[model samples]
Target: MSFDRACRVNVGLREPNVAFEKEDWAVGVDRGRLLVIAEHVAPGVPAIAAAVRSAPDDKSAMTELAWGLRGAGLAAYIDWAEDPEDVQEALNSLRSRPGAMSWDWWDDEDCEDCDEAEVIERFLGLAGDHSRRYGAILFEIEQGGDGYLVGFMEEGSVGMLVDNRSLRVVATGWQNRA
Candidate 1:
């Protein structure tokens, strides 16, 4: 669906134009629909798995995860930009660090009003059911103390939440779920 249908305007921002405001970030509705404007960026599963094991919480794990995925493989070269010209610049920045996730544009530095524990709890609440129903594995990685990374691997999609500020899909593929 579109952002207009799936997103509730973030009250913290005066206008929603992707500006660098604390509240400009938005999350998809709990109903499991997302308003993704950019193309999907493939994530590094090996990196994601390693970060998950080392990071303290979901948010921190994502920061590390983004770094891993940024330089993973063929998919690492892709860039998501509003303008085509900006693609190279974004890709450059992404590659600059080599193995770190960027949580710079979070809505509220680690879910703002929501606590880490609470965010994890909520994700568990929603993801548990979703994972069970879809036969997918849903998880949250730390974007930092202020953000989270939530991910879901299903028959048709591979998604992750960066800093818990937003959810981005790296790959949209299907796997036979038994």
Candidate 2:
């Protein structure tokens, strides 16, 4: 079976539904650095969708807005969906499934003679170790040498609000997760 990522985040506001009315905003982080803070058409922050015309394909094209560091009082009220373990689980699934040679090697015919060490490393790269509360950030939407609305943000960095909550949240999260 294929893995699906259907995560969402709502901050200090009622979540937007498909019927209309998406008045929530979003924040993007990268490499422990704050980058772009934008608004969403729907209440879905982490939910992938278009800026205005949301569709399955529009997830990475949402518009961005300018907000200050910890200016929005949303850090405290932030709520998001479950952190995804899709890539990690998918890689592991290959190990338990029948007809699969091993989890450390490539399955495609192109890698018939590929190096074993490289193959294992590449396969293991799919697994991510994310913060328990802040969550894992594995992908970014970059094009033409920049991350669309998140150009200022780096790829694979955790997004966080620059408020007192960030310290407590991160500290507590790590302590608990650790």
Candidate 3:
């Protein structure tokens, strides 16, 4: 199991149309912004992350993850827009570096006994060699709160935290559990 320090949110309050003040996060994406994008995003590049984050596939968090990975010399999972519309421009920054490929398609054809930790070790090695981070945005549904959290690992250890109150984020971090 993964280490978890997740906290609860107050259920009675309404989620605000807020944006992350942190530079590491996507801008202009709160409740209202997401609603607007839900209608516009296509189905190709926005999948798993959308389900995890509660944001549409075209929203900021997933885009940022793709962008951040490519920008930092890592492989990008999606064939992002080269000159995306102003709204889609954020994803254009991360081009695949030389000798890089999106780790999403990692092959395990030769190792049936690889097990979970070995697979994670291999993924982490590749991510570290390329300076790429891995993470996911999961909604904390247990508390009946509309809070979304980023569970991530950038260059070192993993972490988990939620945006509380007015939806302001002080930081970000995630990786799928092995």
On TM-score, the leading prediction is 1
Per-residue lDDT for 1-178 in model 3, tens only?
1223222231112443223444524433344333322221212335423442564543444454334333342322321122112211222233322223244434555335755444443433333333332332212111111222211122222122223221111111222221
**Full-model lDDT for every candidate:** 0.31, 0.23, 0.29
lDDT value for model 2:
0.23
Provide the lDDT at 145 for model 2.
15
**Model 3 vs. true fold: TM:** 0.21
What are the clashing pairs of model 3? 135-174, 151-173, 151-174, 152-173, 152-174, 153-174
lDDT of candidate 2 over 64-154, digit per residue (tens): 2111211222221111221123323432332111232233423445335646433322332222122221233222221111111111112
State how far residue 46 of model 1 sits from its true place (Å): 1.9
Models ranked on TM-score = 1, 3, 2
Tens-digit lDDT track for model 1 on 1-178?
Answer: 3322212222111232233333322321221111110122333344445554566653344334455554452212221112222322333353212233222322323435755444434323333344434444333221222333333344233322222223432211110010
**Candidate 2 ranges with C-alpha deviation above 4 Å:** 1-126, 130-136, 139-178
Model 3 residue 59 CA deviation in Å: 1.4
The C-alpha RMSD in Å for every predicted model, in order, reads: 16.4, 16.8, 14.3
The count of residue-pair clashes in candidate 3 stands at: 6
Residue 32 in candidate 1, Cα distance off native in Å: 15
On the 0 to 100 scale, the lDDT of residue 88 in model 2 is 32
Off by over 4 Å in 1: 1-44, 73-83, 88-155, 158-178
Evaluated against the true structure, the overall lDDT of model 1 is: 0.31
